[model samples]
Target: MTNSKLLKLPSQRQLVDRLLHLIEFNHPFIFLSGKPGSGRGTLCESLLNGLPDTVRVVSLIGSAAMKMADVRQLLLQQVVARPLFNPQDALADSFFRMLDGKPANLLLLIERTDELPADLVGELWALCRHNDTLASPHKLAIIVCGNDVWCRSQKEALKGRAMPALELEVAPLSPPEQRIFLYEKAKELKIPTALLPKPKVEEILNGANGHPSAIMQSLEDIMTDRRPKKRQAELPVKKIAIVLALVVAGLLGLSYLPLFDGMGKEETREQPQEGALPAPIGSDALETNAASGAQASGSAVNGDQVARDWQSDAKTLPKKVESETVTTESTNYEGRRVVISDEVVEKLMTQPNVSGALPTEVVNELTGVSSAGATQKSAPATPSAAQHAQPSAPTAQAAPKAAVPVAVAAPKVALTPVSTLNKKPKNHYSIQLMGASNTQAVDSFVAEHALAGKVWVYKTRFRGSPWYVVVQGDYASSAQAKTAIRKLSPALLKGQPWPKSFAQIQKELKQ
Candidate 1:
């Protein structure tokens, strides 16, 4: 219910989604609201464009006409199956039933409601109450769009309403969206300001302030002036050269001095001879050795350091060996221990030039494969293969699973592939994705398919409870339907599908 979707300006996807949500949920009212010049009307049109041809939008602009007679124009715009003969009849009720036999709902977008007097809004709200009628099975969602929230201001009139309106404010376009709009606008004009220097370009965008209307106005002025003024370069090359020369000469002069001679030369602090003085932790000359366990002359390092130092040396040990029993042990290659799988090693040994253990080329090739998809996953190969077997228990049991090949195939589907049957029988089939027959389910199916009335939800009650059944794609034959069902990515599907023909569905509807 909280439409907290961030919509990029000029891109109507989110706006369309929100409108679909309103329709699917049977939301009584939506004030197509926004700040002034936020492209509210344009957003409405964008949303309307995606709607099915069956869904009629009766646009009533409040500012354009005030008298009751002017609203008749809204009805005349659409091809009406039945026209109202009584002017005394309430506008909302007449609009609701005006759709006579429309399979889909009617969307009434009353624009510029801010211009309409508060009294007129009061009459409209009172009039909109009829939109929630159960008679005629008519669906009408009234949307009054304007810059201000009119209903909130007229709380007195909305007091007795059976259903309240949900206000959705269309925010101004974001900075990025504004930039895109400006660029596209400039493209239409064939100007180079859109690609102008950064500072100047940013200045132009900054002037727009993330508003579509402002972008059009500010971009015009900037586009007329194609280029930005270039500033002069000010690097002191001569001063830098003199500084570098002085520093180099000073370095050469210091190199000859005795003070610099002893610098950086390692002192050969010879270890104590057999019966000579020993350096201990208490001595001032004691120093640390990184590799061996000797922190001081004739003194061993702590046991931990001795272990770490030995581990480093062990990594450099040669791996080539004769008559080795371990076939799957990890090999220390290039200071990094690379796991050489027994299977890959066995395969390589079958080829020529593999007599001496495995050749370096073979090992590198095996390592490359081991790092790829082959070794990236382990869990899927086991469980996914098991799941596939479970789903088609009898068929899987009858066939022989090639061990390594089966494992490789299993990992691919372990996440989503599932290795289910790729083909199905062709028939007049429909995918029963969900159930609980109501307008809500139908709306959901519509939004999901964007197919409108071409595919629909059937309302039927089972066990004294209403069930809305969501189905899609009516195929001519069972095999065709099965193929269509297979096309549905297993990743997107929630559960096992029941693809049934219209004959099979008739029995369900009866039940």
Candidate 2:
């Protein structure tokens, strides 16, 4: 017996016992199957040694090249031990003659039966089917051993046959069987057990994944110190240094971001009109100027000289800072001396915080100039707001006087460009018109489309840039918003409006 037969693990031993039981009970056909490296052949050899001497054993190796004639010749040579002139008729004759008066059964072991030609395999199945018909005193048991391929083909061959074939499969080594196999393999190689610690043995068994051939190869590699050791993965030193440098540079750049934030607010401040006066600097200065202007209200002041002095001093002050620091009353001084009274100051104080160029009628009254004279002399230098309002005033004045109370009874509206959709349910849908990086562009779109109070504009970032999106919404669902697209003005429809859910907008806002 070789070392392979000597090392019969628990799984192999179980298969051997089952094979013996099937043969003892006179099973006509037996199909033994296993995968490669599962040690099925080794188990068969071990079973051969334990059988009695009276039993006859004929072993054959199956291959694709072997024909029926070749099989008969091989069988004759093994049974008769002499060359037969004609083995065709003697094939069955020899088998019956040997077992005619025998008290023992014959076991035919064909290994690697899956490699045989397709027709030859069919012939073998035919032979097993006629096992009971032979005129012999003892029975003949046919055992075909092969991998999973042969097992499937044999099953297909016996689908409707009356004869039954016993099938057995050899499984892989279990955890305990793997440990014993490794220890025995190491002993066979004359390697000391002390050299293979328990931890290394367990690792090798796991690495082999229950394959006996792999376990043997791994054991040989360890014996010769050819196995590579496991090492921790490491990054290149230059790559580590480069990554750290980039992180530090990014943090330093972020540290200077606040300085540029204030710069945008400075650039966005409105520039004063060309002939405007510089507003007084402090509250104390404004009180002093107001008292003097009040006394001059009763007398006629030189409006042209006052305008020249105001324009001359305006050049010395920063134009942008004057807008942020001045009150509503100071904004009225536009290269002219305006009458200042207690009642006028009180009314100005009571007005909402509004900032823009005054109407031409108001400017003409304060400067004490005829409408025709001011239009001809300073028409080019006049503020665009005052010029725009001049064409729309006649329409307002022509309305019936009774409409005044109706205007006062109307509800106040929010005209700011920022979206009111934030207060709505996040799941509600809206129609998106467009997006812009500047809020001014969003405001201009709303005004140009005549959708001042009908749309929402909200701030979000797009590809690392500040973005504002114009949307008309508060629809209960996306389908309703999509249906509302046709109701928009023709100018708005040209921008290709699309519907979006407010839940998505809220997510972008958080980012």
Best by TM-score: 2
Root-mean-square deviation (CA) per prediction: 31.2, 27.3
TM-score of each: 0.37, 0.39
lDDT tens readout by residue for model 1, 44-127: 666666677766777766764465555544544463655754555555556546555554467767778677645556556655
lDDT of 2 by residue, 292-324 (tens): 545444333234322211223455656555332
**Model 1: lDDT to the true structure:** 0.58
Backbone clashes counted, model 2: 0
Q: Against the hidden true structure, what lDDT does model 2 obtain?
A: 0.68
- lDDT score, residue 169, model 2? 79
Please, what is the whole-model Cα lDDT of each candidate in the order they appear? 0.58, 0.68
Report lDDT (Cα) of residue 27, candidate 2. 55
